[model samples]
Target chain A: MTTSKNTDMDPTAEPEEAAIAPETQPREVATIEQRAAAAGERGAAAVADAIEQGEDAEKAVGVLYLGIDLGTSRTSVSASNGQRETIASYVGYPKDAVSQKLLKKRVLFGQEALDKRLALNFFRPLEHGVLKSSEEGTPEYEDNLRAAKDLISEVIRRAKPRKDELIYAVIGVPAQVSINNKQAVLDAARESVDSVMLCSEPFSVAYGLDMLDDVLVIDIGAGTTDLCRMHGTMPEDADQITITFAGDYIDNKLAEYIRETYPEAQFSIEMIRKIKERYASVADEVDKVVVDLPVNGKPTSFDLTDGLRAACQTIVGPMVDGLSTLVSTFDPEFQDRLKNRVLLAGGGSQIKGLDLAIEREMATRLGGGKVMRCEEPMYGGAGGALKVAHDMPAEFWEKLK
Target chain B: MTEMTTAKAPAASALSVAQMLHLMRMEVDNAKLHGYAICCLMIGLDEFQTQAEREARRWLMPAIFSELKAITFQQHIRGLGLTREHFILAVFPHIGVKQATELSEELLAKARELELPGITGGTPVTISVGVGHNSHPRSDELETLIEDAETGLNLARSGGGDRWMQWRTVEDELEDIRGELDEQIREMRELGPGEESDAVASWGHALVRKIVDAFAVVEPSASLNQVRSDVLAIVSSEVDRWRDLATIRQLSEREKTIDLLERRITKLTGSLDQTESELKRIASLKAIDTGISSIYSTVQGLLDGEDNTEAKREMLKDIFEANLALRQ
Candidate 1:
């Protein structure tokens, strides 16, 4: 793992640097390669320790490690050792002279690559509920795959898996990724990871939460909206549906509407996104405030009370309608109970009035039920992956990515 | 400034004057994207190059500085360094991307030549100049005049390239853009004697009257765009068969339902319960598509064709299949 570029700084670390933390003040003519070799050794030691912990069979420590939250908007990865994270499911490039010089680069990804957003070109890797890909000969082809690869690679880098450990990653694919899409994700992940196993994102969330018995998991993020009905066993395809309208949909609609009303305002794909995250509210607010909007070269404030209210409430109706449909798919005996337990996860679930809004709409549909938000914000998916790793054998784990 | 004059000259490079304008617009737009405000435009001229038949140029080739300096004799004028943030130099590759490069000195000389207010020159004035804001944010017409020096230099040279030119204060030129947009909107209101009238705008004036007389409420998904589309085949064909067309009234009703559906969509994003409702809705809609198409078409065929009981019975079976699929 010691890259050629690293040895010129540590010529003599090649011999004595093999020991722990002893590379400092060694040979006079050290080359970069020797230093790089030292770095690789340290990396190897960390992996050995992580792998040892993963192999633990006792209740306190299980060597099997995992990370997953197959998301509607984006997928997140976490390991048993508490490393890794979320990857934005988008990729794009600058289009024209304006965009080319401004970005100073060709392509961008995740939150960064929103296409030629600066009046140039832009593309999203996942549109609606499926992979956003086109025929290889088409112009839109390589971009989406490139983004997915970049995202997976970034997640693996975050996990910091070691060379010797039997690295296994069980990634949660969208319930809608289709068998074909799941296979594609696994193939894409093959390069950065040792092995791959695909699981339904929603079910993975429920299993992570230990709510497999009579529960529902709704993972809402920037990309898509997903609902999973969980029973004692792994949920089936009939139990899930990925909706196109999620956080981004609302943001875009708001942006379109706002642009017409305030034509001079300089609205961006990012600022509006941050604004949605910051102040988008559905439930009745205690403190109503006007947001200052940048219009034409100046700042203009508008009473966003009604606009925010309407925009935030946009997803509520579809969610309720979907929930009502999902409940009927449950066992006849648990129909009423399923109505009582709803679990909301993912970033969009963090909206202030989200649970209350959901519960209100649901109560009208199902007579009454409790809509619950997950406590963990960033780690639920990773936590779930870790849980899976703890029980499964290392070899089985290696099959998942 | 009567009718403006542009001396049409074949461009000295592939990047024509229009291309330069577009490029500047793009750059400004890009800079604005990074949240930067650029409120000025500046151009400089190299008059000596304009005069000589074998025009020698400076500001680009530094390795042959002695050769470049020979062409720039009016080096008597000394100056201050223009800041980078306020400046963007668009000279040839002979100069390169960096101002520190060799070919950059000619542009640098011209920029430095212009002191705080202005710079004076002798009769050897070689390059015709134009100075105006090429749509840079902070410019008005006066600043645009400064920018117009490039255009003037081109016009002076009969549309050849401009030398050192700078856009003066553009407080006035920006009004032309605003005025243009304002005129467009005003024209949209049907102000002129000969301008074409817009029905959408003309009819919208009497708000309450327009509502009372409203005849069409277009459907959300049903549009002229849906005419040749296969996605609407069943829906459109059913309309043809049953004569239960998607008329203005039904379209209005559909629009209302669609609006209602959007609210439910918003509600559904936060809760899982709405999933069932959505599925049910889709199922019902799909059923409606099948029924309205197959049943109406089948009955119409039976009535128009054999006009027999047996044909009607077969039609009933077809209707049954469509109904069963929808109900499930």
Candidate 2:
């Protein structure tokens, strides 16, 4: 494929033909809002400033398209107004009047909430691609729903959309999410955006890369590992497998083993999660995993190399097991092709040597296989969802609105 | 709180309205950049028009203005100016219209106690102050802001000079409304979908729609629905495909056992080797560790047809079947 950048007008070109070309575009003021949306971080202050520069202060026109990946552990967004941000899937509300006054906020989000967790009633709204409290008509469920909505809105606002601009967004959820959960996601988004749509997370990843044929996308999320087979079409449920032995499971397993080895060691799930994120590998040889934890109120270093590796390796069994099933059942003619194009995505795929480990596992059990990790694991789903939003026809967007 | 800075006392002594405008602009600009509100106060000396009062004005005005400035300075008011017969003050850094009203009330009370020299207690230099906050003051909008403050001063003078009055410009009022709407939107988001009372939620929905319409967003929901329907259609087709595939049972009963036998043998041998190594290490080093290493480095659960491994195939089939059932 040849890449072309148009610089000048060809006077002799056929007028009608050139008019229909996808390369052609209409000229406009190229306002700061447009440029910011294109660049992606344009926030409220920036929008306020941009609107001040408009020729007509009363009317500034723009559209901000957002693609959101609402994961269990982290929420990510890519906006047309050139903003991209990710925050932990955590929400916090001040415990009482004193804390509220001290914090100077009624509700806190993302890292701010995590840092000030002691004064907050913390809630993580998502679990396994849906609201943790997705049940009907309960206070806890309502509270969690609120948290999810706030988190979604916070991520969207992080894009810094102009109040004058239309916001249309597409969100990616787990491929097999229930209709009710999908409805909840849609409802949450409706308040924050003009129109919204939902797509399968793994499919969005595939769509983002334009890899629609004979490809296997294994998205290892915090709560689940989703394996989707793309054979030049929308993958059916039979072609996708979701297993729960993912990032969170690895964290818990690592914590369990560490406790067994160092009974007196003081640690938290949060601490273990950080350690895993920093140094998770399933390889036989790894750098020395030395970490310090309090034991009897004294900090001590422990050699947890084996424990970490063992914990990281636990997911390998279930993932490969699922991969093997998807591969064997595919059309026999394209089975080899599918085996050769395993694309690893999601936060869990960030584990060092994971692709290699999966590859090795595939070869030993399934004749031969290849595994490749996404370049930007954390943003892959969001990027894909954005692509889906971009490629979706105008009619689809209109119908949703 | 009578701690007026000696340095600023000279500036307010004979400051012109033009000089006051320039200084007020700088202070307002700084406050705007830091997201703080600043209020402009226009105070008029009530009975300075009579010939006798005019003769006493020069000495009486400075003393009264100086006293007022001194009183405001103690309250941490940031700027002060005197323009002809009008005394102006800019109080800043988060002092909104509400706080500005309170400051005006306090100033009026203090002005009544100021005993003008050569006048005894004859009217006591009762002054009226008009207060206006520089709301949403863009660079060009500062001139309008000063006019709005002046209008407030005129209102107080007409309503009888002994009282304090405050007014916000129309633009400032709109900005306040916008701020309130934004805050409401934030609260609505915090409430989540379907959790808020229906009436409030409905209003939020309508507000969001109006906002979207104002932006002229082209709706893409129909296409979005189309894409969703396509995904659902694929699901239906695949289900039909699975039904066709399910009817065929390829592997023989004998083949399934052999596959299971191979796995059991591999597992037992690996465990035996691991036990031997652990024992040797403990005997030699006297280490008291009980960490069990996993046996298979790579997954051996797939059916590699060369070994006629039926059990692994069965496992894959079972998993696939379970997934299919779940989808159904």
Candidate 3:
């Protein structure tokens, strides 16, 4: 392995495998005696050590609180393995009546539940974050909560917490989760955990980033683009705003535009999103992007260069306008700080020309400052919670519940 | 050993810490997704869960590829450059737990078209989250913030599944009462137990005085008895679980003879018995008679609790002679 050259040497073989040296190795008695004695002692000691370890291996149970991040698209559960993430967040659901009878369970969770969604009801429970009926105390609303409760409970049970472990949680709420809807989710969550607390989605990202200082976070989400301003320690009414113009907005616009251009183009919303993700750009690059769209049940190609950019840029105007005002509300001096220190922490920041666009707009307003994106958007929020859990004194947790 | 190459994980379960991170990030990207906090459960599935090398590689390969993904975090460890965030970890799930936690695969495949802001690649970004208040509350908004996230994770564990959550629960109500009871019970630890009960029987103690002692009757018990009682209680409450812990510990030890023999045969995974036999065989070579074998026997005897310490020391000389005789 060291030299690339194949050096053939063998001890448990004939003379050809290994050359006998002119000077043979003298099997020293004294050294062999020493090793024998040492090995003897070591073996005895190893036995004693093993016995001791066996006796001490009994696991002691302690009360541990857990936090779960169950996003519509994926799920993550946290508990103490030194600190959080002690188990994989997963649930298992029976695929059919036969499966249900065989398994004697309704649903599984995490990867197990997710991978087999097609065979089950696959209820995400939240459509655009609230009951589609848009009313409170309805049956669909209640069924959703019940389903959510079942899923969460299974995920928690998977964590295998002690009977003595005091489990509590704080959940991240979408910025636009209506007060009634938020309360309903909280009420449902209340059934599963010992305690529950709610905070904003973008704010959670902001909090994760330690962006407590003046900063702006534009969380570009599926159904919405939320702009939040953090001044001092917490977000106030004027500090945050959620607009229905994020990824989903772009998808809808892109679908409409593409459909307008090619009436026979066979495509779903997902296809357009893929096309946008591949070719959509806000910067002035007019390169053509060719994609296959199903035409009358067959595939056809189209060049969507200008249209992609136009669609991708749709959310920018509203988001920029909202964040601009939020920035201006801060003191003039702090506005400069906020603009320059603009921290784009959500999925929206992944847009190719987003940072540039924000930088350009902010530069015109506050002279010159840069907009930065978080490196790990996936864990940006959870990592913040972990950071808080690790850094804060244990006693601090005692007072929060 | 077969030299067949295998991917770093099984095709079915591609779970890893890095994948968890990517998924959580994708949740943050969802447009309609709202939550108070987030939680991520990262399992070191590589070394622990992998039953076969082929399956192990399959699970681990995606992570290597994800790390090699041309965007975001890949810039830090390799290829293009990006600065480390002071080696910090972030928790971003507190606000959106109430809504959008149960993002479907239907959604993930079409996230970009759905205009879901979070999903960058085809990989879905859903986290099973629950919302709850911290049992140990803190006034610092940051502490409260963490408490909310922690509670959500707890709920997720307990079945606050598929979707996000953001609120306190009925269980929270009970814990509040328990917290108050604990506070009251703290004052009682000061007054000793059995002595107070004795005084009460003697008609010299007040009811309040006895109540002030947390365990007036049990406190006077012997320490050994206390330990036995505690162990028994653990076994009783947990039933087979606490009892099975002892057995699992026993299995983790290397004292099993079969295991030793296998390790010796394989050259990498043998146990103590094989080592003893190998040593005895080597010691029977020329110039060395059975003297080295005697030493091995002595060592084995010591392990068997032989009390002949002085005789064992003297036997060392004969063993040394046998070793020297073999070399010459």
Candidate 4:
């Protein structure tokens, strides 16, 4: 039984002794046992009081479940309290007191940070859907870890959980995040939540939509595209594939094409990314995508329709190749079922006519197949995580906490 | 005399004024929800109040309506007949004030070229046009748009007709008030101490009256509310600046206590980090008394689920085992 009250630390205890006492000191062990017993008694008393008052025990212990999709580019959260929010995966600290006063903030997140980067010590803590560094104790790692913690805290704040409600969060990480990176994410989230858990991003999406059987979910994120095969049970390592051919890849390719096609047109990766988000399509015919770029410091319109489409098309082949591997390796009888029920999701999945494009590619290579886009691609992972948090047994959450 | 009706019009028929207003309301609601621009134009004949035969007026109305529709059809504008000589045109989803004004001018020019049989030879039928637009429509702004178009129409009619006018917005009125206030404040500062107080008092009264007059034109909105709060905040801040020395000294002492408490909390938090394991144990125990409980208490509770109950239970079990292993 978890109590709402936090255990206090003895201020006079030496840090070195505190760190090493758990292993060597019987007295310390006895103290821990005594505290745990006291906590158990308190929990029992709370539940008994609630029962005596004829109130639901669970309602008396208010808990808000949160499902978070911590992506390389954006972090989204869906709360049991019916709040949903997403912020860009960027954290910025003002460079100095002057910058802080000018910005009127100690730290900024998301687009505001990007817009005011000149005065900010900016950090995008995640790369390739995992913490950028795995080595412990290095200054770079510590800074990034701090940024990740702050980013998580800001996102949870946006979820607007009631102060009286305990926060139980389930964060969706990339399918193949290393154990160390997973630990780092847990460490970051634990600071902001009472209980936290990690699940694979693609699995959460599939679970959220209840398409668990013979469904292949392709989550196209900013840093990686994760393909997971769901077969009515938990997915194993063999069931998930990740590729770097994703949103950032398309932005880079579009930037390359623009530089090649219009030598004088000046554009940044940010500008190219904005254009890709607005006009990314792999269809045969699309509306003309004319974007303005600086030419000799003058704004000039350049036609990027073909370049943008071509750049977007670059991902389809790799995606289908990954899909081919998943389908070919599956049991022969369910391979077709898997192929026909492909689900496209995530921010990159919002590309115009991507489902049809994926279907067309599948038809060419694997006879014929159908692909469906999630209704809310951006919220799918977080929403699924929320569902997982909700359905998780109370005991499991207690143990995790 | 014309009767107002609120029903769908035939392919060649225009909507009645009442019907148009209803449709405009719906369109304005959509625009507000979707964050788009919409414009309305009020068009009326300039100086054609001759007691023309009722037959002549009736004959002239549809022909003029069809011509106006033709001029606007390429732009997907909708028209409503207010009277035999007056009509309203609505352009929506993306049209703004400038575009609506241009459309009004185009309609006026096209109306001048019409050769009706009932009219005297070689004398063109000139029309007055008024345009109003909202780039970001809100629930309260629909009526403002209509009133603006009506006001512009009246202005055009009074200016000898055959012209288009756009009504000034409340924002424009607010800008004027701001300008006047700035000037008055500067003048008051230049006055002697005694005169300055009198001037400030008079200026404050005038400023409140001006704000009241400007805001009375439209219903209170978020932006207007923000302005009101800003004014209140400035006044409060000024009052605080002039507080007595004793009260200010007491507030300073309280602030110092607050700072000390904050620093103590920070120090306590630093020590709390040393007892991470102890805190974890407490947290795990705390979970025993769930603050907000999950919908289900145990795995068996999922048995009655309508779909995929078995699969969900297995998945839940798998997730729990994985998480348990990680926690360990």
**Quick one: best DockQ, which candidate?**
4
Which tens-of-lDDT digit does each residue in A54-108 have in candidate 4? Answer: 6443224456778899999989887765567778898999886434533547888
**How many backbone clashes does every candidate have?**
123, 24, 169, 15
Per-residue lDDT over A136-245 for candidate 2, one digit per residue giving the tens place of the 0 to 100 score: 67998888889999899888877666666667677988878787777778777888987677877898788767677889999988877888998765677898888888
lDDT of 1 by residue, B86-119 (tens): 1222321111122212223353443333221111
Question: What lDDT score belongs to each candidate, Candidate 1 first?
Answer: 0.49, 0.67, 0.46, 0.72
- For candidate 1, please provide the TM-score of chain A on its own: 0.74
lDDT of 2 by residue, B31-101 (tens): 76776777766667775777777665545445555655666566776554543433443434456777777
Model 3: lDDT equals 0.46
Higher-lDDT candidate of 2 and 3: 2
- lDDT string, candidate 3, B14-56, tens digits: 3332343344345433411442343221111112122443333
lDDT by residue (tens digit), candidate 4, B1-328 = 1111112121333443335456557777777778777776666776666666333444444554555556556677654333322444443546777777777787777777765654535567777776777752332255666666766676677667888877564335445545554554555456343443444555556666676677678788999888877876675455444444434565676567657655655554544443344435534752453232333221212435448887887888887788777767
Ranking of predictions according to TM-score: 4, 2, 1, 3
Task: Give fnat, all candidates.
Answer: 0.00, 0.00, 0.00, 0.13
Off by over 4 Å in 3: A1-59, A62-96, A99-105, A108-118, A129-133, A150-165, A273-280, A286-288, A364-369, A388-401, B1-328
Cα shift from native, residue A307, model 2 (Å) = 0.7
